[model samples]
Target: MNQFDTSITFPNGVTLKNRLIMSPMTTLQSYYEGTVTQDEIDYYTRRVKGLGAIITGAANVEPLGKGWQGELSVAEDDKIAQLSKLAHSIQSQGSKAILQIFHAGRMTFPATLSGEQPVSASAVPAEHRDPNTHDAVPRSMTNAEVYATIDAFGDATRRAIQAGFDGVELHGANTYLLQQFFSPHSNRRTDEFGGSIDKRYTFIEKTLESVFAAVDHYADRPFIVGYRFSPEEFTNPGITFEDTGYLVDKLVQTKLDYLHVSLDNYKRVSIADNYKNQTILKYLHRMIDNKKPLIGVGGVRTREDVQNVLGSADLVAVGQQKLVDPDWPLKLANNADDAMINDEFKNAIEYTPLNAPLYDFLVERYGSIPNI
Candidate 1:
């Protein structure tokens, strides 16, 4: 079987029809009230194309976990109705619906989370502005609050299953709550949840345990479970290659269906001492020991880029490519390489399913949209 087009089964017996996956990228397209909007539903439906699975934008696990004003929510029973619509819409197009569950942590603002000061593993304020809110001063999370948040992850998992999602990917990357705990630059606690390297991992470990507990009880089908993480952080006391190696080894022993590595470039070499010149994806593929699937993502825009990423990891995820052209993988499957991406941004309003908010955000962030 051609690797990218082959069907493979997970440890839990769930099989993805193909290897192409749509990575989760935040699209502030939901209703302000936290319900899924018709535009958001149509957005995902149009993006499925030929992808085997679609990791929907991160959904908040608690009221205080909201990262942006229009992000999807899985925090309550009432949300299941909209979540169900989302799951069915994606699945109806033959894509497995994997909800990316998350808590924004220090990345959120007090105003977004109902006036609660953003909380993190420690009181260390974020070095940069909170991207969405522009600025946010965060506080430390109490020990009890920590456990409560962990339980909230489990609650979110239950909600995902109840809403008929095929699986849930824990949002551990991108400076969220999970990353905040794992990052030395952010986690400075003297308690069991911080300080030593092993202690810092406690938060991720415990949170996964809680989430897995929910899956064990609620997921009667072969539901896939995955973790997304960034290999390194740029801070002074950041997450290093060694730290990621340790974490990868631990993940291999778990029930995780896959480990998704988030990177800006799939082949960018590391400057870390022992692993200088080695790409992060290559390092992780080795550490995983073929015990589980590894998804490599970042700047994968073409068929050749996807092929290069597939050379190291089990699957390739496209974020910006999806923004530019939602039918990326579908075109590739039809051997339509030249037609894979929409090169006409000016005509995006004519052919793109993107909501106005997302279209504006893309042009603002990327500086230029395709001339379509």
Candidate 2:
């Protein structure tokens, strides 16, 4: 049997049909208030072929967590109906649906929050990717607000259960709220939630506690819980590979169903000088010690690419490639590489499942979508 066709089961006893998973990719297709739109549902439903699971784009746990316009929301009970539609659309097609939940924290803009300043572990500003753009300095989250945000995560988890999702992946990566607390660059608090590395981890530890509690209280069936984190950061005083090792070690000892390492390439090496020899994926796998499945994703497109990533981790996730061709896994299964979308079909409105906004976002980021 082909390597990609192999099945894997999580510690929660949830089995994935294959090794392929659709990474959570934001489509900017949701309603302004973050409600799931029909376009988003159709897009995910069309991508279910031959995949084990699909993790929907990050859904904020609170209104202030909105990072940008058109982000999906699990912030309130009213959004559960639309979220249920998204989960059903993916699960009905034989693929597990996992909702990626998060809080944008300091990564958002004032305009996005209706003039309210973004809040974080501290009043620091995040570094913008675009050198020319200036990031707004955020206010420190009050102790009361900090506890409330943690509770918000718990509420979000309950909403996921009510919406019928198979799991929820905590968005602890991409320098979002979770990462902000873990990052010394953003978290300068002297309280219990900051100062030492272990202290900084308090927020994450507590957040996990809240999430698992929700599962135990509301979920009548097995539900997977995963954590995604960046191995290292580029800013000074940022999280290092050493720091990530500590975090991963602690996470592995928990009831987490899986650990996902976010990267631009699955085989990419650590940005830190001490761990540059081996890929971060292999290092994380070693730290996890096979206690939980490790998902490796970044720029994966072809069969060879998937195999290469699988060598280091238990699962391979497809991001940009899945967007380019929703049948990415299906094409690989059928050995129909030539049938993958080409330039002509890429622009064909009838052939593409992406909504207009998503198409514009893709074109603006990647010069014409590449083959999946």
TM-score of each: 0.94, 0.94
Steric collisions counted per model: 8, 0
Per-residue lDDT over 1-372 for candidate 1, one digit per residue giving the tens place of the 0 to 100 score: 137888767888899889889889878898776789989998888889788899999999998888888889898899998899999999997879999999999987777877778888987777766534434567889999999999999999999999999999999998899999999988999999998889999999999999999999998787889999988887889898889888888888888999999887888777687886678788888889789988888788778888888889888888767866877787888889987655544445346667787876666655562211
Error of 1 at 128 (Å): 2.3
TM-score, candidate number 2: 0.94
RMSD of 2: 2.7
lDDT values, one for every candidate: 0.85, 0.89
Task: For candidate 1, give the lDDT of residue 234.
Answer: 77
lDDT of 2 by residue, 1-372 (tens): 227798988999999999899998878989999999999999898889899999989999999999988999999999999999999999987889999999999989889999888899998888754434445788899999999999999999999999999999999999999999999999999999999999999999999999999999999999999999989999999999999989998999999999999998877888778787788887888788788889999878777788889888899888877776888788899999887664443454345656789877766655554432
Give me the candidate number with maximum lDDT: 2
